[model samples]
Target: MTALTAEGLVLRGWEPGDAAALVEIYRDPAMLRWTRFPVTTAAEAEVWVANQQEGWAANTRHSFAVLDDERLVGCVALKRGIEVGYWTAAHARGRDVASRAVRALTAWAIGNGVTTLELRHQVDNEASCRVAEKSGFRLRETLPATPPWPLPGHLHLRTG
Candidate 1:
């Protein structure tokens, strides 16, 4: 994936060396709760990074590390040209990192011919709901809590 710069932040592909930084970010309970795949140990983090690389190669998923002045602050991803998700570390909360990263990714995806995008989060996660709205996605429906999603969720959509 191409590196993107926006609003004093950089969104770039995950690299092998990024595993260590990701380990630090995933230490937060919020990350563990929100993410499907949690990267707790160095080995898990490495495998996560490798999976991201493979996703990029397959053109099926695209993930970017959200950087602020070269420091890792968050992450964003576009999967299957439809679904989008993002997270901001505890240190970066309230700084609008998630919205900015998602917007940047959304713009790139649209430019590459993606007509619509989707964002979903547990209904209890008001913060993620806000991020989805701030990133220009509108709530489309309520999803029943499924096995992967522990709680009922909101589905947000953005169409180009």
Candidate 2:
């Protein structure tokens, strides 16, 4: 419901117009391979945006569209007050977009009363691990593969 900005990146609430871009981002093989959400169609993208808004309204999650100079380049979110997740657009990769967004979101969440935040990525996702580290999260533990999430992962924690 609120917009945040730093270092030329704007973190804002999702809008209906973002559906196409969301679909584009989701089309990446890596995106589909790493996350649970697979928004392959416009309708699915709409649903994804709607769900984000719904979560925000319910106070269970906060999702932001990461923009670079007004162009959507990624997303960063806090779920259930303790988990943080993010993805960068293919064009935005290597620009430190995810890390910067995570740092900004972490600060916002902590200021809003969140005491701790967690980030987890599949064990092989070294990029995510780097982002977590750069964003001030430290590796905590490794979680065994579960039913839905079929791969082992490292759990990183950052306390406010």
Candidate 3:
């Protein structure tokens, strides 16, 4: 995928060298609570990065590392041209990193022929809700807790 840049942040394809930073980001307690992926070890992180590369090659998904001034700050991804997800490192919170990344990715996806994008977050996660809304997503429905999602969530949608 092409690298996207805006306001000093760059969203680019994941690289093997990014595994260590992925480990640190994924190990954050907030990340652990929100995502179901197993990323506790460097090996798992390597697998995660590999999966991202494979997904890109298959056209099933696109994952980007969010960088600020060349420092890894988070990630944003679009899956199956429908679902969108993102996370910001603890130090990057409160700076609108997630919202900016989401907006950038959303625009890129729509420009590439995707008609809509969706995001779902646990109902209690006000921060996520804000990010989705700030990035132009509207709450569309409520989904009950399921196997992967451990809590009720608000499903948000953005249509091009």
Candidate 4:
């Protein structure tokens, strides 16, 4: 997939130079709170980036580096059939970066034959819900106390 840009953010593939910024973004506490995943080490960050590269190589996933004015702010991806993993740097939140990124990805999904796009967020993440709505994904239902990964979250869908 080619790079896409919208709303002052560029979404493109990972690069070796993006490791440092990506590590910091993933280690940010807000991302941990929102996504319930922790990345505390540079090594873990490298592994994650490598896995992303592998996913791209294998065609199992499409990843992008969220860049704002030449700086890597975060990363987003469409993984495993319209499941989007979006995490922005703590500093990038509240500015609608994730919303813009998701919007571009959703348009691309529709172009690529995706019938439905799913967004799952922790029940407590109001900011995420707002993004989903702004990107045109309607809330479908609340999955009560699911398992392993935070329960009682919401499921939103965008169908065309």
Tens-digit lDDT track for model 2 on 44-94?
A: 999999999998999998999999988999999999889999999988999
Residue pair clashes in candidate 3:
none
Worst 10 residues of 1 by lDDT: 80-89
* 7-85: candidate 3 lDDT, tens digit per residue: 6799999999999988888777998887878588999989999999999999998999999988899999998878998
* Candidate 2 wrong stretches, greater than 4 Å: none
2 versus 3: better lDDT goes to: 2
Candidate rank order under TM-score: 2, 1, 3, 4
Candidate 2 local lDDT, residue 61? 89
With a 3 Å backbone cut-off (N, CA, C), the pairs that clash in candidate 2 are none
Error of 2 at 22 (Å): 0.8
Off by over 4 Å in 4: none
Task: State residue 117's C-alpha deviation in candidate 3, in Å.
Answer: 1.2
Whose TM-score is higher: candidate 2's or candidate 4's? 2
lDDT score for candidate 2 against the true structure: 0.93
Per residue, candidate 1 scores C-alpha lDDT tens digits across 1-160 of: 7999868899999988888998999999989888888998999999999998999999989999889998999989998879997889899899999889999999999999999999988999999999999889999999999988888999999999
The C-alpha TM-scores of every prediction are 0.97, 0.97, 0.96, 0.92
Candidate 2: count of backbone clashes, pairs at least 3 residues apart or interchain: 0
lDDT of residue 41 for candidate 3: 90
List candidate 3 stretches off by more than 4 Å: none
Q: Rate the local accuracy (lDDT) of all candidates.
A: 0.91, 0.93, 0.91, 0.83
Candidate 1 global Cα RMSD: 0.8
